[model samples]
Target: MRYCLGLDMPGDAALIAEYENWHTDIWPEVRKSILDSGIVNMEIYRLENRLFMIMEVGPDFSFDRKAAMDAANPAVQRWEELMWKYQVAIPGGKPGEKWRLMDRIFSLQEAL
Candidate 1:
């Protein structure tokens, strides 16, 4: 399955740079956690302060399972805490929610 989500970064250019730098060499544990959670592929894009993520997951993936796994992994928790410094929940998102799932309004395959 594929999921697309949106988030926001602080408007500070320095902070955005730092966030990108961190992704350049993400910690092994953090990478492992993502793989173990059944995310087969992931990509993140930025447009000014707006951020978008595309994730392709295997059949074994579930948000609840991933959340439980992340909660149990101290390294993942630490990484999330560090990332929160640069990330902000999109408007209407719950407090502390970093990514908001986006609704797909149009798809070429569906349009056909």
Candidate 2:
């Protein structure tokens, strides 16, 4: 399955640069955690302060499962805490949420 999500970074150029630098060499533990959670592929894009993410997951993937796993892993928890320094919940996102799921309004495959 594929999932699209959005987030926002602080509107500081330095902070945004730091965030991008971090992604350039994500920690091995963080990458391992994602793979173990059944995420086959992931990509992130940014437009000013707005960030977009696309994830492709294996059949066994579940957001609940991933959350539980992340909660139990100290490294994952640490990574999230560091990331939160530059991230904020998108407008209308639930409290404590960073990434907001995007709704697909149109798909060429569906139209065809």
Question: TM-score for each prediction?
Answer: 0.97, 0.97
Report lDDT (CA) for all predictions: 0.95, 0.96
lDDT of 1: 0.95
Q: Candidate 1 residues 28-86, lDDT tens each?
A: 99999999999999999999999999999999999899999999999999999999999
RMSD in angstroms, candidate 2?
0.7
Candidate 1 lands at a TM-score of 0.97
Model 2 per-residue lDDT tens digits across residues 42-95: 999999999999999999999999999999999999999999999989888788
Candidate no. 2 TM-score: 0.97
Model 1 misplacement above 4 A: none
Best by lDDT: 2
- Point out the worst 10-residue segment of candidate 1 by lDDT: 88-97
